[model samples]
Target: MRQKLILERTNEIRCELNKVWDITKQYWYPLFECTREDLISFDSNYIMKSKK
Candidate 1:
């Protein structure tokens, strides 16, 4: 019963966080738009390396 309640609370927290992120994402900007693409590529490469 306690585990179920914990899971439910966790899900609620995650939903709230997603809502916050959705609002925050709209205001996020980069000095150069291209930098966002570079960061994304770098993140993907890092993720791939870590997966091995």
Candidate 2:
């Protein structure tokens, strides 16, 4: 019975990790296009130009 409970908890943890992985993939791809330097600071000008 204890082993069954542990297995259920493990499954729950796996499901939660999968959800987080999906969210990370959704947002990470665009940032992957950026140079390492671009992420160093927030730039309002870059954002403004990007909107055009």
Tens digits of lDDT, candidate 1, 1-52: 3455588898898779656544244343342233233234236677899999
The deviation in Å at residue 35 for candidate 2 is 20
Q: Identify the candidate with maximal lDDT.
A: 2
Error of 1 at 36 (Å): 14
In candidate 1 the C-alpha lDDT for residue 7 amounts to 83
Candidate 1's TM-score? 0.33
- State the displacement of the C-alpha of residue 12, model 2, in Å, after optimal TM-score superposition: 0.3
Worst 10 residues of 2 by lDDT: 32-41
- How well does candidate 1 score on lDDT at residue 13? 86
